[model samples]
Target: MSDQHVYLEEVFSSIQGEGIFVGVRQVFVRFYGCNLRCSYCDTSETRAGNPVICRVWRGCEPGRFSETLENPLGVDIVADLIRDLWSPSTRHVSLTGGEPLLQSRFIRRLGERVEMPFYLETNSTLPGAAVDVAGVIDVAACDIKLEESGVEDDHGVLFKRSLETIEIFNDSDCLVFAKIMILPKTTVATIMPAVTSIAEINPEIPLVLQPVTPHRSNPERLIEMMDAAGRYLRDVRVIPQTQRVLGVL
Candidate 1:
């Protein structure tokens, strides 16, 4: 991959619908590719195949993508598109993806050309990649995959990697938070280890329990999970994918 270019799925502006930053407006730059194939992944299209053209939405409106750019996109070109999509209330440039850390080099370069803080949304399974881009990241929304999420981590290697990645960003200047996607089947036993690990790292780090979209979590189960997390972590909140509710990208 060239330092000047990156594979992108799309560029748009919308409210952040996950993590503790839910409802915050942002310019979302969706990079392509991912390492993990979670059962409930909504962005599977970006996980494997490379896109031939990148969809750059017009302004911050949903479903108003009046522009399209060819891939691989130039870093400066993406910076300009982000600037064009930014509003006074836009909090940061959301560097999201199938897994943004896969293209950490491009993220570092893009961060150089953009003024807004880089908010990285990652799977938290690549510690080395995290190091490469941690300096430029302002907010790290690291995902903790549960066994029930259909991620094939037979020996817990992926979970260990996630913890390492989290530690990297936590030690950096970035605001680090752990986000666990809860399914209807997600139990207290499955989530406790992640919460414990995060607490061991820093009890001050916020934890966001995002119930996978379209699959309503059992209220009782969600409460139990929150209570369990609260005992270890200082801050815990339940958020959902509101972008789908608002019909945005």
Candidate 2:
């Protein structure tokens, strides 16, 4: 297992920018690669092939950066970096990605070795992979992509898996929540089904309406979608990319 490692983009500490866990301090272990490329996506690094090396900061402080670590970094090494950067305020070890679920075994193994709680930030399109790690994850921050999300996915298949992923968390003690990227073209027709689908599965799970970008925010549209979602789901909120606003990594 010393040679076995997961490809990663970066590992750093920052606040939880979206979902019900927003504002909580977290150490983000961002994995490399993703299945879907949403047009409005801000995770630009995820679009490329796996990096030959994984970058980490020398310290947990926001701006400090460390020498790159080789790709497919051993679980022990990844575990050390996470432990090194963890701070007193750190809430959980956030397994974010290109799609963290893509590397289910790594997450499962890492969760076993780490002392911190594991919080998974994922695109709920991959239910099978979600199941692979669901048993180990402490909090499931699942993103349900809508048509307005501009990802290359079969809507029926996408929604079905999204439901399955949510249900995976529902059947467990993991805190589950959904975040839908509400674009400018996003309309009630496009939004209702997602909220309705989530409502049908578990209305108690919070839904976060995040505009494509925080700089050119469309508050009216965000509010409208929030209002529309509020009808079916009890806990729906409009949260912008506060990380982008506060200028934190």
Candidate 3:
């Protein structure tokens, strides 16, 4: 874990397949590491070290290597990278990773350099870190993992912290979307409390309930899981991995 600059696994342009930005074309910056070991993680390899080539989307061959950047990039250099990735159809930039909040300061500085809106995809476990740069970000797509994800839900304490960070961005012109991944093992009993809690916080915040992709798990179980999740989360809808469906990068 080098501290000078963040290690990146891949960076490519792709459709924003989840959250409010779903289907929107954007540049994805996938950083190299993470703190959590959720059972359903699709990017499990990202936790340890950088990979030579990254499989960006379904059917698309692994994206080839480009130059890697060290952390603490100057605002100008960061701006240039954004420009290089930019296209006429690009709507915004998505700063994602094993956990982007881990590099909050650098991400914040990078966000300051870009003229376009920036979106952050985070696990929402690091509220303190996220709050530091919440003001600079234009949108936050925070994931609130349930106990079924093999993570501790703790009566929604982690969820609450994420909401707190969302509130910080409420007054800014930024949009915040809370995402919950529903797995085969998740139950009605388990989901209601969580959905109710989110509804209580702000029902209008746009909750995205996604069925766990058929990455390492049984695909047959997805329908059952979606059925259970749908019963409780009325505002929720299913969005499978679009990249998988489209066969594109």
My TM-score estimates for the predictions, one after another, are: 0.96, 0.93, 0.80
Q: After TM-score superposition, what is the CA distance of residue 170 in candidate 3 from its true location, in Å?
A: 3.8
Candidate 3 C-alpha lDDT tens digits along 164-234: 66566554567877777877776556666666666665666666767787834444554554455455444
Cα lDDT tens digits for candidate 2, 1-249 = 122578888988888877777789898999888889888777878766878887786554456677788787889888988898888998999999888888888888887889899999898888887887877888998888887677787877888898899989877878998888877787877989888988998889888887777447776767777888899999998877777656677
Candidate 3: 10-residue stretch with minimal lDDT: 53-62
Model 1 residue pairs with clashes: none
Q: Worst lDDT window (10 residues) for model 2? A: 57-66
Residue 178, candidate 1: how far off, in angstroms? 0.5
- Cα lDDT computed for each candidate against the true fold: 0.90, 0.82, 0.69
Best by lDDT: 1
| Model 2 residue pairs with clashes | none
Better structure of 1 and 2 per lDDT: 1
lDDT of 1 by residue, 1-249 (tens): 677899998999888888888889999999899988899999899989889999988755566778789899998999999998999999999988889888888889988888899999999999999999999999999999988889866529989999999999999999999999988888899999999999999999999999987886788888888999999999999888887877767
Candidate 3 global CA lDDT score: 0.69
